[model samples]
Structures are given as C-alpha cells and as structure tokens.
Target: MRMLRTTLDHVRLRDKMLLLYFLCVFIPVVLTNLIFYHVTSQNVKEQRMQDISRALEQIKIEFYREFEDAMEISSILYIDHQLNELLELAYPHPADYIAAYDSYLRHMLNNTYSPVYHSVGGITIYTDNPTLLNSGGINLIDERVKSLPWYSKIPPGRQSKPIFVRTGDGTGEQQHPFSLIRRMNYFYSQNGHEKILKIELRMSSIREIFHNLNLQGSLFLLNERGEIEYTTDPKVDTNAKAVAYNELQLPKDTIEFKTNYVLMNSLNGWSIVAAMPEDEVLYEMQTSRNFVLLLTCANMLLPTLIIIWITRSLNVRIHRILKHMKKVKNQRFELIPGTVSRDEIGQLTGEFNRMTLKIKRLINDVYVADIQRKNVEIQRRHAQLNALHSQINPHFLFNALETIRMRSLMKREDETAHIIHNMARIFRNSLVWNKDRVTLREELELISCFLEIQQYRFGERIGHEVQAQPEDLDYLLPKMVVLTLVENASIHGIEPLKHGGRIEIHFELRAGRLILTVRDNGVGMSVKQVQRLYNYMQRQEEMGERIGLQNVIYRLKLYYGSRFELNIRSALGEGTEIRIMIPADRE
Candidate 1:
C-alpha cells in the first residue's frame, strides 16, 4: 500500500488523467456497445428464422389444397353410375365402342369434371375389359398396363380411399406428374371387371404456387424417407426426379426450418423444409453492425480527444507553476507571465504571483533593515555588558564573596554563609553573556540562586517553590528569560505585601511547546494595570528598565519570533499569574 502511494506520487498529472479516462470512460463504452451489438444481431437472426418457418407453413397449405381438389374429383367419379356403365358395357365390334365413347367419354372429357376441376390435367379409367376402346380416357388393363410403376406400387388396402403417387418412368431423366388413383367399385357390375380411376394433377400449377412464395432461400417438399420430391431451389430442377435430402451439397452454415403435413393421409410424415445460409439469414445485420461499430468509435473518439486536450492544459499550467516554484529556491522571485484564467489553477497562479511580489518587497524593505537593526542592537548590548564586566571583575567578586562566606561560617553564622554563597552564584551567572541560550534546568538554577538571596533578606516573610518535569529540563530557551519573570513576580508581587507572599514557578511541555507559568500570592494589580503591561509586552520599543519583564519578552521575540506567547492575569486582593509559551527545542 505504501509502495502504490509512493509510485502514484511520482507520476505526472497528464498520465494520471489518461489512466482515469481509460478506466472510467473507455472500458465502459466498449462493453456497452459490444452488448448492444450482440443483442441486436441475435434478435435479427431469430426474426429471420421465424420468417422462414412461416414460409414453409405457407407452402404446406398450398400443396394440400391442390391434392384436395384432385381427391374431390376422384370421389365424384367413384359414385358416377353413368361412367361405371360406360366402362362395364360389352362391345361386339370396335365400331360399336367408338359410338358409345363418342357419346359419353368424349363428351365427359370436353364438358364434365375436367372443365370444373382445373388442378387436374385429365382423368383416365383403366379396366380389365378387352372389349373397350383405348382412345377415349379408357385403357384396357393388359399386362403392360399392370406393369406400370404407379399401378404396381399402390397399397392393396388403400382401395377404399384415394391414393396419391408420382407418375414417371423408373429412371430420373424427365419430369414427373402427381396423380390421385382410386378403385371404382361403388356399383357392382355384371361382367365383374376391375376398374380404376386416375386423376392427373397439373404440375405447372404446383410449380407456380412454389415460385410465387418469393422466399429468400431454397424450399423443398420432402417425403417420408427424407427424399426431395419437389423443390423451388434454382439449383435443383423442379421437373427432375426426386433426390435424397442429404445428397444436395448445401452450405456449411445452412439453417433449416421444417413443417410437417398434418392434414393429408398420403403426406403423413412428409414435410416442407426451408434451407437458408447463415449469412443470408443475418444479411440485414451487416449494416447494423457497421453502424454500431461506427457509433462505438464515435463515442470513444470524442471523449478521448477531450481528455487529451484537458490533460495537456492541466499539465502545461501545472508544469509552469512547478518551474516557477523551483526558481524560488534560488531566491528568484519572478512572477508568472501569462493571462490568468478564472479556473482553480488560474486562482492558484494569481495567489502565487501576489505571494512572490510580497516576498520580494519584504526582502528589500523590511528583512534587510531588520537584520541591520538587530546587528547594531547586539553590538550596543555587548558594549554595555563589557562596561559592566569591567566595573565588576568576576574573579575579584567571587573571591570576595568566598572570603565573606568563610568568615560568617567561622563565627558560626551558617545561615549568613549560605546567603553569601547564593549571592556569589547569582553574580557569576549575571556576568556571563557569551551563551545567549540555556537549558530550562540551568535557567531554573539561576532563578533558585536569586530566590535564595531574596529569601535571606526577607527571612520567613518570603516563600517560593519551583516545579518542573525531569524531561522538560532539557528544553532550551533564551538565558534568564524565566528567571526575569520569577524575579519580577517576587519583587513587584510578593515584596509589597506586609505579611509577605509565596511565588510558584511551574514548567511543562505540552503539544510540542514549552510552558512556563509563575504565580505570586502577593499584592495584585487592577485590570487597567494588567492591560497596560500587556500593551508594553507587545510593543517593539524599549521599556526603560534593566533585566525586567520587557527584557524577557524582547529576548523571547528575538529567539522564537512571532511563535512565542505571553499572558498576564492579575486581580485586586488576589495573586498575579504570568504564563509564557514558546516552541520547545528537543534537540
């Protein structure tokens, strides 16, 4: 997890924006378009299959209608007593049969059932009467007639109902015609001659019915054995002999739709099959697919271009800002030279320019002047310290205090000797100006020495306590800063009280800052006086005092700048409390 954050931190803004675009925009658009294309193509394919199914059903209806008409004609002839009599009549001469045929069979051919039933080409009756003429719709059932394919293939039990069959030579070289044949035995004859009725169906009419359907693919009438009895496929000849369904070389991706012939007894298990290539079934989807692709491209292209433009704009502006920021390290406060826009980056650019200008002015007008002033102040302070040191030699002073302390101890004045010892230590610390910073522990020691000397002067009237954490003792601060505050509290707050007072000094570290609080239970000031003291602390001007509260405030200001804080609270008849806060120096 840390490694990913580190890697991303180093990546440029432009590349990051592009990555976002790829994830949030590009992938989703592509997936959506793909799903849309798949769904649309599937729907189109299914609709095509349905249309083919409907076309095959239509073919079945037309096929049965034609066969039904032929059956009707055969039924009419089955009960025709006149036609039966004509076939059963005996003829002694060919001339007599010709007279009978001219009167009945020829008239029947010209004006009867054939004219009414247009689906049939002609109706012929075959009989085993050798006396009948063979010229007029009647053929003598000799051995040759009995040997025909259609006659020999009839089922014996099918004599009661009309039967449908294809009438052609055994060889598949020529077109075949369909016929309905029935045994005409409704009326018994004296001669007991077997008779058959054959109605030849019109092949041209059936072919026209198939062609007019105008389907997109091949259509076939398959028999019970899966043989192609008839087809509207241009590749197969309609007039040719039947072929096995599997023998045709269909397309590899062909789709077939089949509907069975349910209403006709002769056509049981037969079906009309439609075969269409997969490409043809989905032909219209080609245009739709291209449109979807083009739409997908359009969807992706515009946004990608937009992302590029936006990323480029952001990268260029941000890079310019970064370049200017680098120049700032070399103290080159140059303003960015461009028309600032109203966007967030533009606002950032505007803010940066203002900050640069302010920094440049500060360096020229305030920073250099403040450094020179601080230098002169340090020199004056050092000179004053040197004059004081010249006046009071530190070695002579320490030796004189030691001599006085030994005399007091020799006379058995142990308390006086201790007072002299603490005074010597205070003088030693006051003379040292080489180190301006000291640890809290060292500063507290100096304050203890000064407090001890004051205690000697006031005896039982003055009381003081110093509280501090062991860990907080190492924090560095301006030398004598806390001592000065403690001294002020003792002299001004405690010394004025008749019964005397107690001074408490506490040191603490909190929230990366050092806190030094001094409270005195002595004479307190009014609110107005406390407010006046606060005003004095805030001012940079010198207060005409030596090593007092103002001195401590000034020294803290120089050390910690505006980061240090001071608060003074005093109330009439109550103690005064002073709190000082500064940044802690752990090192």
Candidate 2:
C-alpha cells in the first residue's frame, strides 16, 4: 500500500501538480463566471434596451425639429408678400430678374433649415401653372419621375388639399433620387377679384438632413399608408410595415421598435423616423465592459501565476543547493552564488558559503605545498640541464680545437686557426647559459663556429653568405638561436643535397618590423614536412616543452606574442626561404 501511494504521488508531480494547482484556483473563478452570467447579464440587457429606447426618442426629436424648420420655410412662399412677387417675376424673366431673385434666394436659403441641417438641395416655389421657382436650379422633373410610385398620386389640379409626391432629379442617386413634394392652395387678390392660386413645395432641400443621420441599424420615414415614402435605404420594403416594426397594422401615427422605441409622429401630415442601433446607443457601455474584463482577468490570473512561480523557483533553488553539496562532498572548491538574504534560502546559501570558504582554505594550503614541491623540482631540472650543457659545450669545443690543431700540424693553418678562434668565441658565449637571453651578435658568433665546423666537414661542397645591418647585432635575442638555425640548415638541409647548396642569411628593418630571412638552395622539404613544423610550433605553446623548432617558436612568443611571425615558403626543387618578423623594440 505504501509503495502504491508513493508511485501515485510521483505520477502526480511536475506538470500534473502544476495543472492541478491551476485547476484549484479555477474553481472559484468558474463559479463567479456562472454568477455573473445569471445576475449581471439580465441587468445589462435591460440597460441596453432602455438606452436604445431613449436613442430612438432623441432621433425622433431631431427629425421633428428638421420637419418644423422645413415647414416654416415652405410657409414663407405662402406668407411673405414681396418674396411671392419676386418668385413670379424670376420665373418668366429668369435671366433679367437676377438682383430680385438673388435677394429672394438669399432669404429663402437662410430661413429654410436649422444650422444642423446642411441637406438643403434647393427650395422650389411652384405656381398654379407649373411655374417653378428654385435656387441652384436643376429641373426635378425627369422621365424617371413619371414612373415613380408617388408621382401618379398627385391630384388633377393644384388643389388646396395637402399632397406629397416623390419625383427624381434625374441624377443617379437611386435611393435619394426622388424628392418629397407638397401642394397647397394659394389665395390672393388680383384686379379686384378673389384669385385662388395654388402653391407647390419640393422638399429636396431635406437631402442634406438625411446625409447626417447614422443609418446602420434601421432608418425609415413612413407615409400615412404605412408606406415608406423616403428612407436612408431603398430596400426597406416601404409598404410592408410588418418588416420595420414586426407588427401587422402598423401605426400611421406612432413610433415604436421591438416594444422599446416609443417616439410617435408628432405631426400627422408628414413625419420621419430613425431607429438607432442598440450597439450605437450604448457605445460607452461597451468600453466599460471591456475594462471590467481586463481588470478582472488580471486581478485573478496574477496571484495564481505568482504563487505557482514561487513554488517552482523554490524547487530550482533547492536543486542547486543539493548539487553544490554533492560537489562539496567530492572535495571541489568552487564559487556558487548563495541565497543572499536572511530568509530560509539565504540561510542555506550562507551555510554553503562557509563550506566553500573552508574548502577553499584547505585547497590553498595544499596548492601552496604543491607549488613549493614544483619549484624545487624545476630548480633541480634546471641544474641538471646546466651541468649537461656545460659538459656538452666543452666536449664539442675540445674536439673541434683538437681537429683544427691536427689539421694545422698536418698542412693548413690559416683557416683552421680562424675556425679554432670562432670555436673559443662560441665556448665563451655558451658559458652564459644561465641567462635565457643574449645579444644577436653573440648568437651570430655562435653560428660562425657551428658553420665553421660544418664547412670543415663538407669542404667546398657547402657555401653560405651572411648579410646583416650593424644596428641589428646588439638586439636582445634568445641564446644559440642562430646556431640552432644554421645547424638545422647545414645538417638537415644542405647535407641532404648531393652537390650541397648555398645558404643566405639577411637582416633588414622595414615598416616598424625587424625582418630576418634565411634562404637555402638545398633540397627543400615537402608540404607535409612544412605542415609538421608549423604544428611543432603550435604544440609548444599548448605544452611548455620544446624538442627543436618549438624552442625557437616559444622564445619568440615569450617575448613578442602577436607582434612576431615566422613564415616559411618551400618547394621540392626550388629550395626554402624562412622569413622572421619581430615588432621593432623601443626599450
């Protein structure tokens, strides 16, 4: 039973635990969501419906205000005495009546509509004989007007009864192509007889009014027959009052939408109705809803995430502490950042810091002891190297001197004496083996001895030249550097050639660099051997021991680092050229 429970616990760890933790936090949130759906949505819906009703009332008020202004302007043609006489003259003598007509027009447009109504296309005063008066005139009578549904509704004579007509202006605004018209009885005295004149009104001037209303949801202007006389939209099924209001027997007199909108037509003659969308009505509420959602989601999710993160962070820190303790058991002194506070984590890190410090002190003592031992070993090895070198140098010098003495005793003395003197000089330089550095002049003298010995062995078969600037001789250089190079050329390079070869050593200073080159006309190395020499130079830097070429490379790097370069160019039959560059030394 215990094992089964432990296995189950293990299976429930990690992501499973994290998911369960999130679910535990989610339960209350789900319940709250349910409560919100029950309580708040009802209140929100009611609020939206009430707001939509108020918006519809406001729209009705706006339209009524527009209708009132249009009536007042149309009433002017009936009441204003001078304007009527001007319109009569402007009709027949349209060209000659400019000043009178202009004054009439300026007055006609000014009082026609409210400032909010910019849709006044033009105001027309039509007389009993179809005489039309218009400002900014384009004839409203077009072929399409004869075919309009409202055009045939006009009575035979311009009667006193109120009549409405929709006549197109011939321009291609399909929905707004038609203008609203009203006919009224005009009464005046002419030649002392009672003259009954007919007056006509075209409310194309209201087009600008429709342009401003927001028309997205539902906008309709109804006639008394429940027919849509003029609407912002054409497809509103003007005669079907059922579609606009969802009721059969629509009101010729009332304003209502979905039992919410309640603005009735205040004027029985002509009225315009607009139904503002529910979304547009309560646009401000939508922003409040979004803000609530964001604020609620953040308030809920933040704490849950922080709690889960804290637990996971604690687990990570514990794992680091365990790993550090394991490393300590194995006796490693390493720096690990401690938990840097007085909290539980901080206390654990403090203990770890003490352990690491103690381990470091113990390691330091052991390291110092080991260093002393290494220094002693290095001193012993250096002593052995010095003793071996001392024996080797004298042995070589004694043999070379004895060979020169024998040669002198046998026959030649001049060149052999010179060779012996060079040998003595080489011996004198080698005695300063305690010093790691020597002058280039000393190394060149050593090279002279080495070459003299080689020349003696090879005779005229080997030939060489040395060209050096005088300033280059006193430069500090590694001891025996020139001797090793000359020995390498003579032993490995020249001696291998059948007829022997010429070697040249030249030194120059160019462009902040000291350049020394050695060229040989002997049998040269293959590409593979050249690569191996390059590898030998590299290995000495990685490992501090040098067998041959590595020693020269080490000495150059020890002094110059990146400021030195050794480049070798060689081909099988064409021989070899080695160029060494060192940065010009100031001190």
Candidate 3:
C-alpha cells in the first residue's frame, strides 16, 4: 500500500482524472449491463412458462370435453325406453330379431351419437337378452366378459355413472384406446335387466387439439396425481413409474438452474412442464445481450472520449499557467495570454496576468527612481561646490572690494580688518564643499563667522545668539544647510528692516530627529508672501523667488528623501521662524 501511494504520488493530474473516470463511469456501466442481462434472462424464463401453462390448460379442456360427450351419450341411451323395450321383447325368429336390432343400431350410431360427437370412434353395447341379434354396433353378451380387466373398473352400485379405462391390447388392430364404460338400465324390471355400454375415443382426435400450438419448449400434461399423462415431446418417459412434480426443480420468477428449464403447475394440480435447453434459451438471450452490450459500450465510449478531450484541454491550460509561473520564479515577469472563458481557471489566469504586469511596473519604478535619486545627489553636491567656487570669483570680488572696502575702511578703519578676516575664514570654509556633510560644530563656526561680519556691518542694530548642546554640536548635517538659514536671516530678514532685528538659532535632538530653528525679529513678510514661499519650498512649482530657501529645501529633500520636514512661520510686523527637522545621524 505504501508503494502504491508512492507510485500514485508521481502521477500527474491528467492521469489521475483518467483513472477516476474509469472507476466512476466505465465500471458502473459494465456492471449495469450485467445486471440488466440477468434480469432479462429471468423474465424470459417466466414468460415462456406462462405460455406453456396456458396451452396445457387448453389441452385439458379438450380432454374433459371428450369425456363429457361420452357421458352425455350414455345419459341419452339410459333414458331411451323404446330401445330398451325392443331389446327385451320376445322375437319369432333370430333373423326377425336381428333385422329389428340392426335397423335400430344403424340409425342410432350413424345419425345420433356419431354425428354429435366427432371424437367418438365407435360405440358398442352388450346385452344378456338371448333373443337379441348381434350387429356391427351391438354384441351378444359373452359369459367371459365378467373376467375382463375393464369389468373390475365399473363401480358396484354405479349403474349409470361412467368410468374411464385405458384398454391394453384390445380386440382391434389399432393402438390402445381410452374407453368410457357404464352399466345401462332403462327400466326397473323385476329381474333388473342390465346392459353394459362402452364408448371408445380416438387418441389422435384428442391430441389434434394441441398439435398446432406454436411452442419452442416441451409441453407436458400431468394427471391429478402429478403423473405425466401426456406430452408433446414423445421422448419423455410415460411408463407406470411416474415422474414426481417436485423433482423437476422448475423456476418461478427467478431461474436458479441456469442450465435446466422450468416446470410450472396449473390450477388442476397438473403441472405444465415446459422446458427448453438452457443453451438454447441463453443463445436467444445471448444475441439480444450482445446487442445491448454493444449499445452500452458505444454509449460509454462517447463520454469517455469527451472526458479525455476535456482533461486534455484542462491539462493544456494548467500546464501553460505552470510554465508561465516558472518564468516568473526566474524573475521574468511577463503577462500570460488570457483565456476566452469565464471559468475559475480563466479568471485565475487573468489575475496572474494582472499581477505580473503590476510587479513589472513596480520593479521598473523602483529601478528608475533609484537611478534618479543617485543622479540628484551627485548634482546637489556638484551644485553646492560650484556655488561655493563662484562666491570667490576674482572679477566680482576685486570690483566689489575695490569699491566698498576703499570707501568704507577709510571711514571705519577699526572694523575693516576684522570684517576681512571673518570674510576670509567664511570663504575658506565654504571652499571645502567636496564633503557631502559636516559636523554641527563646523556648521556653527561658519554661521558665527558670517554673523560676526554681519555685526561689523550692523553692530548693535542687528544682534544674534546661538544656543546648542555641546553633544549636538558633533552631530552631522548636510553641508551649508544651517549656514544658509543663517545667511538668509541676515540678508533677507534683517537687511530689509529699518531697525535690524536679532536672530536666534537653536539646534537640538528630539525623538531621534534633528530640530533646527532660526527665529528673527526682522521685517517679516505678510501671510501671502509666506504662503508663496511655503508653496515654493514644498511643491517646487514656483521657481523665481526665495532661491536660497528653495535651494536648502531641495538639498534637504535630496539628502534625506522625505524623512526631513521644514516649515516657516511669519506675519506682518512679526519675526519669521524657520523650523527644520531631520533624522539625527550622530557620526
């Protein structure tokens, strides 16, 4: 059993379906045909038996009718007073008596008894009247008649009742006849004048009643004692040793003896045994059975072929899906061909196709996005370096310094060297723009340098303070992100104010994110301007204003993706506060 299970484990779905169809369809059909043939066989046996039984009953009626006719004749003869008187009367001579008796006998036999009963072969009468003449139909009573075997069959007190006898070796050249014998007494004479009447019947005439019955099997007529009285089959043993009824082992509705025929009993205690050889009955059934089997096999064949076709179709579709799945496993995401049907498998195929397309799109989106992200990071670093390099352009610097420092330093010679040295330090730090990120301490130093120069420019009017934890000063941030916010406060917020405002810068870590806020009490913008700046920073759709803040927002987005958050809050006549949040990376 384990081996069988193991073997079956390797069998594919197609083969399993084929095996299931054979068990579910073919085997049942074969069994049904066998059952039907068996039932048909039994019905055939019973129907044949019924037919033979009916024929046997008809033959019985004919036998009884023959005897009934003989009895009627005896009744007529017993009541005939004239004939009785003529036989009893004394005659002058034997010739005169012979003429009277012969005349009466000829008229009775030829015109009355014989004409009425066609089965009667002959009628004979014997009387003890010595004067009566003997003729063809009449006989003189012999003294030895008392010793005949038929004499013992007559009832002692039954003078008019008939009795049947099978006469053996009779006084004629013909075969043995079945006779009816009775005593005749017309009048109650004091001497009790008695006569014997015998009516003979031809066996051929009785057998002729059933001769033309169209039957294939043997038909039997049994007596009341279950003896085989007569049969259409001459080969049957009809001796004195009677064949018992029960020994035949006949079939009722079911044929127990497949090889033997059946004997059925009739209403008259006589069994009508009709039997055909089992081979012959089965032979007839076999022909019909073969026809039925052919039809059954033909019927089963069509569905089996249909099942095979259906299984093959399913196999094709399923195999195609499996093959496509194999390719998907190998990372080749391709849509499978859709089926025209709306069944489950077809729906599954459609879903698979949709899933493959979705996966491909996701993969492509991720791949392209990664490439673009790397390119943006490179551009951000290069643009920051270029901006730093362009800040110290010799032509612009030389012209600006020549014009501003020559005039301003002559007026304020004390602040001139301090501003130049701070400017130089800021420029020197900005020049090292190749690094993608800087420590918060270095960023703070750059902010301080710019703020000190701003103090030189707007000493007491513009003031600033920096508050940060020493531990937070070592944290990393994108290069120039903090410095840009400080520069923007000094140039845009404080420069525009008539009374320059103070700038407060705070850096801290909150919940593993960097919090940087730059608040200034400067000439703050209106809500509309703030909204426009916010929109530019968030959406990057408006490109013409606040280029510094926009550049800071864009760089932060590029460096940290969406993990950073920036917001600005300001109002007319109020200071602006820019708050930035970034992931706290402390290396």
Candidate 4:
C-alpha cells in the first residue's frame, strides 16, 4: 500500500487528472451510452417486427373471411335437397323443365343468396341431365363444359368436398375468377346423374380486402405447391397463369412472414406470405439514433467541462500548498497565504472549513433540488408530447373517413354513407383516447356506432339490445371499458357462429356502484378457457390477441384502482357474459 501511494504521489497532478477522467468519466459514459443506444435500437426493431407480424395475421384472417362467404354458399348448395331434386327430375319436355326452373332455380339464382353474400360473383350448376334447360345459371355438361380445365382437374371419386379453384373463360383474354367448387353427390338417390356446383368469388372484392388492410408489405396467397394464387404485388400480372412463388423477386433486404390455413379444410395447405422491407420495419430507428447521438453529446460535454475545470482548480491550489510545505522543510516556518474558495480544498483550515460546509449545504438545498425538479418537469412534458403524438394517427383516420362519407352521401348512397359515418364515429371514439373517463351516454354512443358498423358487415346475422336506466346514462366510467367488452363479445363470441348471435348490454346503478354487463349468445368458452382468460386478465403483461380484454382491465385498474370487480362466466355453445362493478363517478 505504501509503495503504491508513493508511485501515485510521484505522478504529476495533470496526468492523474487525465487518468481519472479517462477511467471515471470518458470510458463509463461512452460505454453506458453505447449500451443504451444498442438496447433501445433492438427494442424498437423487435416491437416493429411484432406489430408487423400481428398485421400479417390480421391480413390472413381477412383473406379467409372474404372467401368464407363463397365457402358458406358452396356448403349451403352442396346439401340443398330441394336443389338436388330440382336438378334430378328428368322432364320429358324443355317447357316442363323451364317451368320448374322459373319456379325455383330462377328465384334461388336471382334473390335468395346473392344479396346476402355480395362477395359471390355468380353461382352456376352444371348437370349432365340432357332433359334440363341449358340457360339461366344451369349449364348442360356438353363437350365444351366437360373440356374446361377446372372440370377435368376435379379428382374422380365419391369424395365430395368443396375446393377453391381459379377458373377463366377458356380463352386467355379475361381475368380468372376465384371460385368454390363442389360435387353434389350427398343424396344417395342419384341415378348416375353428374352434378357440379360452382360459386365464383368476386375478384374485385378480394382485391379490395387486401387493399384496405394497413400493412406495409406485399401479400401473396400461395397454394400447396408454392404457386402464387393471389398477390397484392403490383409487379406481377395476376391475369396471367399462376406464377411460381420462387420466381417472384422481392426486395433485397426483406423480412418474410407466413401463416398457414387451418380452419378452412378446402384451403388446407394454402398459406399467406408477406414480404416486408427491413427499412420499413425499422423506420423509427433512424430517429432514435439521432436522439441518442444528441443525448450522448450533451452527456459527454457537460461532465467533461465540469471535470476539466474542477481538476485544474485542484491542481493549482494543491501545487501552491505543496510549495509552501517544501519551503517549511528547509528550517523556516511559513504559513500558506491565499484567499481560499469555498470548496472541499478550502476545508483544510478553520475559517475555510466553516465556509466550505455552508456552501455544501446551500448546493444540496438549492442546486440539487432544482435539478431534480427540472428533471421531473421534463419527464412530464415528454409524456404529454407522447400522448399528443399518439392521437395524431387516429385524428387523421377520422378525417379521411369523414371525407369518404361525404363523397358517398353526394353519390346518393345513403346506406353506404350511414355505415361510413358509423365507422368514422367508432374510429374517433376508440382511437382518440384524450380522456380517462367518459359519461355512460358517450360510451354508449360509441358502442352504438360500433354495433351499427358490425351490423352492416354481418347484416341480419348480428342482433343487439341495450338496457340502461335514464339516470345511469349520466354515470361516469373509464373510456372504452364497455366498448372493449362489447367488441370482445362481437368478435370472439358472435363471429364464429354459423347463424350468428345476439349481444346484450345492460347498465344498472345500485347503491354507490355501477354495474355494466355485456353478454353474447354466440359460441362460448369452456371452463379451462375461462380460467385461462381470468389469469390473463390478472396478469400485468401485454398480450397479443387478447389485448382488447387486457386494455379494458388495465383501464379499470387505473381509474378505480382496487375498487372494481370483473366477472366472466361462459359455457361452451351457451355463450359468454362479462360483468363489471365499479364505484359510480359523477365527477
């Protein structure tokens, strides 16, 4: 220890200060900032990837949803005994068949299902029964019809299941239509008559679905053999023959996302693939890098200047003291003479020590406290800025929808205009989260708009009823709390049902608390699923698919703290009920 001390003492003060600055200030600051920058960049990249992945999943869902209409129509037609009997009758005369066709087939073709499933372009029945008329959506399976590419491709057997196929007009002049095809062999009484059902899907409608999604990438639907059946990439001519997936060139630096079809048996081996550019995914990292660089410069500059000034002052003062000590060593008593500044170095003597202590106290009381206060204020301002930035996208969306609604109104499409207006209201209320609490009336308005939009999509498939007392309408609750629950009910509960279902919302004020209940008579959850959902709601972590439920739970906790209760009860095939009880707030 003594040897080390002697070596350190022999070192010049400036050299020691330089070493201290390199070790304590420069190295630590640079390393910490570098680490901070790296971690921040990684986090931003990961978050963006997650968001893109979720968007890809949503796109896949939407693609399936568009085709779901065609699938449903095919399924309905496949098992329609009336249609089977109509197609099976061996009418002796063409007039007799025409009468029968006009009575049933014409009505079925023109009125029954077309209005319900707008995604269906046309439905045609092909039969080899020579007695039937060849017109009015019923084509005789003659040489031309039999020689069609899609017809020959159907596997020969008793196997009867709907399959999705892209068919053209035989000539290469027009675009191919995506269709669902199924053989009508379900009835056992068929006397060797070949029956085929084809439901042509609206290509424009499918394209619109792809266009409406706010995903940053090219989307492709690949069949089992890796052939691109449908694509949003404008470079490829969709009107041409099916392109091999590998032949399509993507961006050099791209991230690919893929999701396979599981629910639709007809689309068993089909997959949705998305090619997103790396730059698009990590676009925000450039801003983050610039901010980090600026912060690092500020962090380094302030500490460097402070350290240089402090070290210089210490070196000069200590050098003078050392010179006086050396003079005293030559047999002369000498007192060091200088006006000492109020610092740690000044604490070496009696009066100087008292002044130094006073200065230290003043710094702790004023300067340090002021710095902490400013830091808090800066943090508060940053939060406010972030909130404002978050609102920008929603406001922009709302304005765009308003413009679309006005255009629709000008075109005299009242129904479309009304739906767009409801959609706009939903986007505004749900996304622009400017407040923590909203009156029950305002929340109900948002829910009403949301339900209206859903009704437009589902038509008569979705039913809703709201029961609330007039007095309860004025009660306050967390914004979107009820709407989130209603959405969950609509999507998870009602959406999966074949015939669809009803959603009921009830609001009651009892004692000093408010009770809000959202129930759906759709497909429900099992006991274990309910337990898992409860556990998920109780968790303080982010969830991917159940984010809506988590958001509602989080907001309730934020607004009411521990003074809120949420209860979920469900049974498979019976539907679900979510009830919430919170202290009534009038302010």
Better of 2 and 4 by TM-score: 4
* Top candidate when judged by TM-score against the true structure: 1
Compose the digit string of candidate 2's lDDT tens values, residues 1-587: 99977866777245655666667666666566556654565577667666655555565566555545445545555566675454443245545455664666565545544354444344544333223434443133445644656556665564543333444433454333333345433645342211122122224544444545443445565655455555565545543323433333433443334221233322464444555555665455566566556756866787778767977767677677778888878876565674376779768878887879987888877998999999998786567456544544564666667677677757867777776767667776676677866666766767767778778879888998998778877666556655666667777778887785788888677897777787888788899988987876565334233435555665566556677888989888778888888866533
lDDT of 4 by residue, 1-587 (tens): 99999999999989999998999988998899889989999999888878877777887787787678878877788888898998998999889998998999999876788789778778889999989877868988999888877898676887887888778732342243687888889887556889988888777777777763556778888888889877888797755677888887777898898889876778888998888887776788877988889988898899999998988789878887677556645734455566766776665633533544565567667987899999998676456433533543356788899999999999999999999998887777657445557899999998999898889988888999999998778888877778888988999899998775899999998888999999999899999988976776567653223346765665565556579998999999999999999998896
* Candidate 3 residue lDDT tens string, 196-264: 888887677866864745445556655556655556666665544557545665444322211111232
Ranking of models by TM-score: 1, 4, 3, 2
In order of appearance, the predictions have TM-scores of 0.56, 0.46, 0.46, 0.51
Candidate 1 is scored at a TM of 0.56
Q: What is the lDDT of residue 491 in candidate 1?
A: 85
Clashes of each: 0, 1, 0, 0
TM-score of candidate 2 on Cα atoms, chains taken together: 0.46
Candidate closer to the true structure by lDDT (higher is better), 2 or 4: 4
Give the poorly placed runs of model 4, Cα more than 4 Å off: 1-7, 169-176, 188-191, 312-587
For each candidate in turn, give its C-alpha RMSD to the true structure in angstroms: 11.2, 16.9, 17.7, 50.5
Clashing pairs in 1: none
Where is the poorest 10-residue window by lDDT in model 3? Answer: 257-266
Q: Sort every candidate by lDDT, greatest first.
A: 1, 4, 3, 2
How far is 545's C-alpha from truth in model 3 (Å)?
A: 63
